[model samples]
Target: MVWAWLRIAVAVVGFSGVVAGFIVNVDRARREGQDLGLVLANYFSLFTIVSTIILIVTFVIAGLWSLRNPGRSPEPRGIALAIAGITGPILLLGIVYNALLRGLPSEIALTDPSGIHSLDVWATESLHVIIPLYLLVDLFFASRRRALSWWSLAVIVAYPLLWLTYTLIRGGLTPDPSGAHDWWYPYPFLDPHGGGGWPSVLIYVAVMLVVLVAIGAGIVAVGRLRSRRAAARTSPVGAAG
Candidate 1:
């Protein structure tokens, strides 16, 4: 019951933040005479935004299941795997943003000295920090989860791998709407034409892939441990054994 409500709350907050940030961004771009179509395209292209939306959807589904089932565990094998898979990328979003992108000048004109700028700041924090941390907390402390197989790591890595491929291909074909560079990438580290060229971009991508897989492995291990503990608690020979 409590967990169901918590999941619902998280979904609500995430939905609100993503929508508000997008509106603020569109408005800012329009005010500055930028093309709205290009702005919307670039906005949705961000990994952070996509990952956050995935998280939001997962929680909404989980929450609704819990509410419907009441006392039963809402996370079956598939749902548990989905949660485990997304954990890595979502946490990576927070790690990358805070470590590399926090202080950088945003393309969204986040610093505008206007009334709605505060909303943008809050929205940014929700997407990059608040929701990520909440997911981490839920991953560790949620009462129920199913053990995942070793091969599930591949499933976990697939979304991010596809996202990277799409980002690079689209970036090559698209021009920067802001005219800041010939190509526009959501993050500078992934920009092939930057100072370190393709080599630098490859290095960054490799490092991030390694980190993401590591996070996934950790989640799988934790899920297995938790599943074992839950089983023991319900067995005839309990924790005393």
Candidate 2:
């Protein structure tokens, strides 16, 4: 009973956080004369939006299934696992890149001339920091391990690749407000005009790919271990019978 209520709480908090962040960011962007499309175009916002929606769906389904069949374990389909697998790694990347590499308080918070408000900072952290951690905890405690597969790693990798392609293509075509030849890339690491240049971008991509693969494998392995333990715990009763 407590576990069930906890899941409900998590879903509510996750939903609130995502919605709050979206409202704050969009309002600020609009104030600065950016359209809704441009505000939503950011990878950070896109990933968080998608991830939170997925999380909400997953939680609701689990809740409904539990209510319909008490004491019976919930078995989520592979699609949910695949979505979780992809979101997990990407959110991790966002958190790490923003917090450590970007020097969170100094770079991500203070350096932005666009004026990062308190609400904006909280929203950013909620998406990148809170959401990722929430997913990790849910995966460990609530998610059914049997639904996950090793091959989902490949499917998960496709997301980041797609994002990279879209970002590069858009950045190349769209001009900055100044009408200069320079285009606006979301992350500085991906921007060629920056001091790091193409080599840096390549290195960042390579590192991110490696990290994604490692994280995907880890999630799969953890799920498998949990499944095995679950099977083992039940095996004794079958043997007795």
| Leading candidate by TM-score | 1
Best by lDDT: 1
Model 2 lDDT tens row, 48-149: 566566666766666555556566464556545654555555465665557555553533244345554666666566656765676677667764435467
Cα-lDDT of candidate 1: 0.83
Tens-digit lDDT string for candidate 1 (21-65): 798878877778777888789988889778878878888888778
- Pairs of residues at least 3 apart in sequence or in different chains that clash in candidate 1: none
Q: Please list the residue runs of candidate 1 whose C-alpha ends up more than 4 Å from where it truly belongs after superposition.
A: 72-74, 107-111
Could you report the Cα RMSD, in angstroms, for every candidate shown? 1.7, 3.9
lDDT of each: 0.83, 0.63
